[model samples]
Target: MSFRSILHDMKEELGSISRKGFDVKLGHGFRSKSQRVVQDNFVVIDAFKQSCWANMPPELLRDVLMRIETSESTWPPRRNVVACAGVCRSWRETTKEIVKTPELSGKLTFPISVKQPGSRDTLIQCYIKRHRGSQTYYLFLGLSSASYDDGKFLLAAKKCRRPTCTDYIISMNPEYVSKGSSAYIGKLRSNFLGTKFTIYDTQPSNAGAKMTRSRSTRLVGSKQIAPRAPAGNYHVAHIAYELNVLGSRGPRKMQCVMDTIPASAIEPGGLAPTQTEFVNNNVDSFPSISFFRSKSIRVDNCQSEAIPIRKEGMLCLRNKAPRWHEQLQCWCLNFNGRVTVASVKNFQLVASREDGSEHESVILQFGKVGKDVFTMDYQYPISAFQAFAICLSSFDTKIACE
Candidate 1:
């Protein structure tokens, strides 16, 4: 079908609407609202078309809003709702349900403020109090200042009573800073005294370089400057911990991640005894271990070689984002067991550079997208859970044709 004809057909499908109210068929050889409105009155169609989706139909708006709200999209529905509201009065009424309240969120860094000594509540004291009984939670707390006061950053000492906070993965935008103390970073160090969170600092230079001089020059490249060691330091509990989604913590309750013991797998969580070496030869594929089944894997921060373990009767790998050498088909699982599956999955690997350059990757030569359309950002292997779901959902697809 021609693009125009296909587009026309799609609209015909959309114009048939049964809203909560109007079954009023403004009809006659009228296939849909667009056609009736178009042939009848230029003035009316002009007005209706001008409205776009605003005055069209409440049912349609509800369906669209539901889809947008429930399904995934890069932009916030609030912003889109606001923009659509601006388009026409009907849109404003239809999209009035969009919530635009910005909550406490984003990568956290230091210099958090303490309320005045006599004041009833400071942001830090409030957050600490609210989080008193809390297990790991995903929350955003803001810093009141850009620099520290009297040589100390305020967030430096507000400790979480939960011992688990010590292991909490603290992630932040690399740009947060306290300007005055270039040499006196000791202030920030005190923040970790009572808790167990280790910092995973991202380099500012590593932030996407799509920028102008004004933005690029701001904060003097906050991502790059060497941070001063936090002051009043105690022993570092754990140097590195895996962070879950956007620095979210583990579930409020411990979530169990399960794995199936394939016949070839070795005893569960015991893979070192397996002797499957990393080889590129096409003889045997390394057994696939879905990260979903194994939520977190422990590995040495700095490891020399890939280690294997035997679980069930086969081998299970802890990390999947291996440095794959095509010549040597087997991958080099780098982390000892440190990276979270969510962290690896959520990794924003832009396949192209800011200037729009791309690496040459094997196309794999199949599927809907043309060669090399896949990358860490958009493509992923079939997850173990998905595979199991397919097996359950299928009657014919599961069994291969003889």
Candidate 2:
């Protein structure tokens, strides 16, 4: 019999039973066997009724599903597209086509947790893409869960207008700004045509709302290179962080080597030039000297008296040498701190050693704690602000963004 005939017969049987008043009740208000059988038949008929949509034309069905997916107004739409794909074979194929379009997939989402105004100890994830035609790069920084698009926007950075400009204005997402506050965080300024740059914290002070260069941390090549040379001409052999200080003679330098050379830039049958070459060429440059405050006091008579003092410890950024990962197919940076290897995504920071062995202890850890939030842990000597800045830097294209 036709589907319509079966459906009609089932409806007629249900109506006839209702009109007959054949309400047979079992013990404790349970339905009688006859009622149960009728209910089961209804369920079977309903299942067939639901299957009618399965015969819909592929194009029409896909259009309906696409509407449902796009109707979600939030970043990382709440309706799980991947889950929808699992419903049937046709849906899976259609989902693949829908997601491949750049309009749907190019953007990323991250959940953000902002504890207070100007808080730096927050976890952020950055997505970076380089546009070769424009010779520029774009960064989408956010907090997200499961690497899905349900990300909350935090900050964004783009190259300045000038073609030779290496400066990028790192701005706060307007949606995150309060009524009276400005959306400016700071600027990433490069010195030698992307060879070196400083992260200038331009956050306004709470009391005066004045824009001050609160803290400046520098990232530079380990060996000095001429300012005029194209940055890509030489691999980013070594990258260092120059810690910001207060009333100090100069910033302290902590350096690490990086295999930042792209495979395309590698010369055939030869390694990149050694650091020794740059050292030899710049020997005439004068190095700044630092002066330490005297801790000892001079006695009234003439003798010098030594004072009992607590030892001051230095804070450093320590990590193991970044290694290439076959699965990730990108270099991995593992730190010797609270962060576990699993929490790290995209890349990490590993400590370099003189003896050429990896360091097992981590000095700082920036790990995800929630869908839109991350935690920062660091030992003394590294302020929360400095650690936060370092984490933010991770979201940019290390070589090009500099």
Candidate 3:
């Protein structure tokens, strides 16, 4: 039937159903039919019955009632929300779908749990039942510092600004029973340190974990490369190419190598030209790759893979190697570090000829180089380069003076 016709039929049915006989007394105390209005036992229930006997289908009527229950209202109408649910079996079925089988309160929202003799995880189960189809959701947590005044400002200006998720502070449990490649299987405690409150996933988790949208997904920059994979032979070989010092001296530039080393710059370890040979074999005045032994190759700072090479080579002393001045926010990449008797490339420490042909790149050690006396390359296939670079067994930090 047409919707108008259907609505007309429903409206008629709703009008026909008389709640006049349902004594105003029936809604409250179990008063006899003749009970007076003086007692707290009556409902001018025509309004309630009107709500219950909605001319439309029970499903549609229920949906209407649900919207009303959640929308803005002055006097709490849970009673109204509940009263319509009890009119008849059909009505009961619809309302039962909404009213708390067991009501919920205090720091929680959703389907309620009623107490009974049976054991039930009503609170949790009700939530699970609602979202069982969609199994996973992420949570991001951030701890920040802000003054009380900021909190007031935040409450008012939240619509205009965004929260910064730069740093996080949390106390870690001293002990944990881990699961298969995860900690989710174990219990965790969050009696974390003192901090400020701001907008984020501020939802509290009694179970020690809260999930919310604002505190989830972290943003990353495109220039940010992934962490180092397990140190391998390929990386060792890559560094070997970086250490190859054969930059063209005569200003004839080299070409781009793409992701790999340039074909002309691909001399392997133990195959570099020594200083004497480079000076004698001065075919085109290319800087010697095997010219100097590495006095030291170290990985410093938290980058873990920041290879710094303190070796013997022609440094670009005249024009200072470009450097990044943090305070100035200026980048002088090539003119800051050890000299490149060569040119520079995009995101690289390249030593190239005048035509910008790449010759050599700076390479530092791979694995952990500790403070004490441990070798440069221990855990992988990088022994050859170490031997090739070490001219003197030890530099002058110890017994023999330089």
Among these predicted structures, which one has the highest TM-score?
2
TM-score of 2: 0.30
Residue 164, candidate 1: alpha-carbon lDDT: 16
User: lDDT-based ranking, best first?
Assistant: 2, 3, 1
Query: Residue-wise lDDT of candidate 1 within 196-251, one digit each (tens)?
Result: 11222111111221211111112222231223322111111111112233544221
Error of 1 at 272 (Å): 30
TM-score of 3: 0.18
* Tens digit per residue, CA lDDT, model 2, 1-402: 533453355455444554664432222111122232346446522222233343558887687667655654344452255444443345556755664321113222111112111112222333333344443333333334333233444444445533332445444443332111234344444433233334443322122222211112111433223232111111112234443434333212333232221221122342211111011113123232222223331111111112111112211133434566889775545433323334332223333333445344443455443333344443221222233445444433333221
- Clash count of each predicted structure: 33, 16, 27
Q: TM-score each candidate.
A: 0.18, 0.30, 0.18
Q: Report the C-alpha lDDT of model 3 over 1-402, residue by residue, as the tens digit.
A: 443353355445544543333333233211113222332575434333354353458667777656645541212324444444444445545655653322121101111111110111211110000012222111111011211111100000001111221111111111221111111111111111101111111112122323221111111331111111111011111111122235432211111111112223223331211111001111122222232234332111101122223112211101113455679655444322222222222122233343434434432111111221111111011111121111011110111111
Q: What's model 3's lDDT at 395?
A: 14
TM-score of candidate 1 on Cα atoms, chains taken together: 0.18
List the global CA lDDT of all models.
Answer: 0.23, 0.34, 0.23
CA RMSD of all predictions: 26.2, 24.7, 29.0
